[model samples]
Target: MAATAVPVQSRGDLVLADPASPVATVPAAPQILVPATLSTTLDSRPLDLSPLAGPLAKIAQIEAWLGTELIEREEATRVALTALLSGQHAAFIGPPGTAKSLLILLLAQAFDLSKFITLCSPHSKLEDLMGPLRLSQLPHDIYERLTNAYMPASQLVFLDEVFNLSGSLAQTTHRLMNEREFDNGNRVERAPLISVFGASNQIPQTPDSAAFLDRFSFRLWLGYVSRTNFPRLMALYANRPSSAVLRVLAHNMPIFASQHGLLTLAPPPVTLGQDELFSLMWAAAHIPIPQSILSTLDKLYDDLAGKGIYVSDRRWRQSQDALRVNALLDGRGIVTNDDIAVYTNMFWTTREQRVTIAQVVERLGNPLAVAAVDKRDQAKTAYDAAIAAQADTDLDSGRKMNATVEALGKLKETAQSLEALLAQAQQQAMNPTKIQRALDAVQGWRKELSEYVL
Candidate 1:
């Protein structure tokens, strides 16, 4: 079925209209103005600027933009964006000053969506997250919360330090995050939320918020840049002004112009409509899961359970949605080994578990990498055999020299081809650590090539 168009009711507003229902218009919500100065030099990496044809292309654009803007966070950004496309929430676990809040805010503005953002605290009131209640006409006894322009109406929401939400506020937000519906004074109102991006310095400790924490599909742990990249990070920050400095001199169009003009002007067109996105998500959800992956998941479930990090059955099922999105975006009809890497983030409880999950997933999820290792080993054996054959005194000198040259040439060619393969893989790597490991291996091989200079 063709997707229905859910037009914005007001400027930058996205209304949560049922896909089966006719177009519904709601009052416009207030927009949050983000300064154009917030944008930095997107990485110089080649970008696919081809015209976007659908929601998938829009997501690709966002992914490319994220790669350019952030350093060493490609995997986390991709997962978070996938969660958003899948109509699921994501959480970033990191200390302060890690660009978690900034990235989410930038994404909301990039899509021109209305947003409700706040720093969560135990003292946060319902009126702050939602809205205050008001009496109705001719019935002082009847009242309703004024949800206009609140979290209930916004398209994107960000809660910094989300673990601090407690008591009744936490209970309300828990329901809101889970169902996308909030309780007003007298009725339940559906929120127009595409995704809620949450950030916290620590994991939720209180029992009350743990269930709320489980709602996030992608949980990423970020930290300071590594020593190797720290110099590049400093150069980027010191040489140029951070993108967040708004410097627009638009004295004319006050209605349409602000520090945000730099961001709004001639931005990339949004190709995916809400209906199409939802439909794609529906399709992804139904994609077939192979028994092998199911078995791998079963083992993973038992492994994590042993470590006291239990993933609920529901989470295990919903996790398929992310893998499905990954396959769909990659233009594959079925999920493959590459998609299993998502479990690293989907099932982990702490940063240490992230390491364990990654190692396990690499072993079980990537057939190509495993094959490459085997092939490299086989090539090594063949090279050694050729060298041994050349060393045989029973052979003629002319033939021996020829054989030695031939063996050396073959080994060099093998190393060169493997180096080229590593280069290609590095281009698509979401995780920098894997790419670095490949690079190290290539360097070691290059050094060994010189030692074979017989």
Candidate 2:
């Protein structure tokens, strides 16, 4: 079969079309900086990444907005934005009302891209998702969407209740997610999709949907807010006006009114060139993976396999991209032990196994750092236990005093040891961010130890 020729607009420009209209051109640049390219070619060609100098800054702005807009979702927001920068799909698994769908929409607004969203179900048809195919206007034998206002043409797509999609729709979606292309009743066409954001209340239990689930490179498990943040969350949403308040409310208003509101209430001033993003992605794929992490992953695979949990070799390779992308987000040109935090999302097959996987990754990523954290946590637990024992009538006051003293001594020793380790790490750590984290932890431990009573 001959490769279908898509007319070139600009060398790296993303040409926007109405899908219903005969030709598509780039949209007019609005108030905020314009976004460049969404999808790269299937051949894995390096995308032009010249414009990426500003993306990290832009991403930081979006992350700040997400942190304030959604309570307790700072990490999830970063993961999702990283997926966008890497030009990969992300899925959010959580109960409804956790702002899963809202995050995707907010990103679309920030990028000023066309947004397409659908609530998927078992009964959904291909036409419902991709739009109905119609006879082509051109003489060639082909079929295409009658309208471009569907998932295939949109820059950002959100498929809520994605796991609920069943039958042929699920299979079609799997192809869409993997290849970013689908047969349009006549010929295969490239999807103009940039990033797909899927949300579900649970992971797929059935074999069919599970395959589709694996296409998402970044999968985040979200849950309810903590009790400590519940009241503050309520107050923020109820009494506080967010940065997104004006734009979100104007969504349903007239186009002129909405555009004006958007122009005035631009989310972030930074822009990411399509070429620059693609170049970064190419760079990330080649970023060095430490041999230690590779060995650790191999052992982790064996350990998990022994427990009847299995990960495909393909998933393992794709996970490398996640690590590289994480490194890029951390402002590193190279992958380091610190980036192994990516495994916290990759190594777990079950939600219950997440904590264990996190611990394993933390130990492998930075053994000394993890050890310090563990010692501090243990000291805290011992101190808390001693205080509770002191309140008990059965425990003698002298015994309680001795226990408290022992716990305090352990805390002091651990704090001092961690401080020494932190000082040593600062000289050798490649990533300054990781070193600073160790420094902060050591300082926190010292402060905690200073609060102890004789």
Candidate 3:
């Protein structure tokens, strides 16, 4: 056989001549690199479910001290305690003399030393909260001393005038409030069993930041005592002992801790059921709400929606938790309308909002009672006039007019009756029977309004 001619390999420009030559494969396109950045987006953030430990006895002691001084504030304090025990923070806002600070100290004194720590000031620093660094005293470098001084205990910290802190200091609190940890150089230093009791003369117009606001699970407005409770408060103030009952109660803090500890670890979550909805709807139907009042409710709902404020889905489920506690305090197993009424007040952003919503519910429940009786009289007059004018033309007109006048007379009577029902329904000493009767009467008038256009 003739010697096979050796095939010469081509250089850089060589092309494959064989049908079965291996094809050149291009490397997969490199993934677009994402720059490392801090997450500011709230949606991606995890739920900060850090464990919370608070002395319930302390909360009860504080509540007892509040006594009858500030009924609204007292109720608000109960709600706040419920929120705190459930592992949440509360922000109490009020005028200077509303006893906001007093409540904080009272509550703090109730906690076991291991469970609560109080820090008050306009100049509280992160180091003060986490613990101080001992640079010069340390055998190692200054930074090493700082690393050794971290306190990791679960204690309640009371930050009075919390809004006055510098932005950096506040930012550190924002982290501590949410994550229960602070950035110490390269590592995160967890706080020892930490819970914050922050009080302010007024809630900041704009919170230090959204993160800071989110850290406070409940926001309460503590107003002055009701006029009815003023006398009792005065008596308590005038006869103030060397140590008030609150102090005595607080001194027995361990009793509260034991009682609180006995409370079921996880109480059932709060829920809005048919009874709540009916009670609210009945109240709404009876009250004659002004357009302005309706607008306020709408605005409040919108604001809460926009800011993602109010209770979170998980916490919203716990909104009714206070009801149970309130009931337990009152020695009841099932929550009643009164319990709900008191608890709902705690969730409102302002006194105006709470009063307005209550008014709307009242008006909706009994429109006749809420609407001006004089206006209905005027409407009756107009109807009578229209009937009289038609009477001269036809026999049917005279009969119809007479019938219309009779109907107006009956409506006036019904309206007066409904007004009485409404008065009883709104009474502070209202009973279930009266409320139920008022609800029935109001429902009747609503149906009547639908039928009688004039």
Candidate No. with top lDDT: 2
In candidate 2, stretches whose alpha carbon ends up further than 4 angstroms from where it belongs are: 1-52, 135-143, 228-235, 242-266, 269-276, 290-296, 390-406, 430-454
lDDT of 2 by residue, 1-454 (tens): 1112243443243332333433223222323333444435221222222234455666566678777767888778877877776667888998878888877766666665666898998888888888886755445655566548887777678899998888567777666667778677567778767788899998888888877777787788999998968998889768745646565656656586556654323354455545444444544554456667688777777766765667778778777777778876776645677777776766564687777777767767777667666666666676667667667889886777676677667656766776676676666673344434544554464465445443
lDDT of 1 by residue, 142-171 (tens): 557777878888877888988788856777
Winner by TM-score: 2
C-alpha-based local distance difference test score of model 2: 0.66
In terms of lDDT, the poorest run of 10 residues in model 3 is: 44-53
Candidate 1 — number of clashing residue pairs?
A: 7
Pick the winner on lDDT between candidates 1 and 3. Answer: 1
Residue 148 in candidate 1, Cα distance off native in Å: 1.6
Off by more than 4 A, model 3? 1-72, 113-123, 136-154, 183-194, 207-211, 241-454
lDDT of 3: 0.46
Positional deviation of residue 86's Cα in model 2 after best superposition, in angstroms: 3.1
Return the TM-score for each candidate structure. Answer: 0.68, 0.74, 0.47
Score each candidate by Cα lDDT: 0.64, 0.66, 0.46
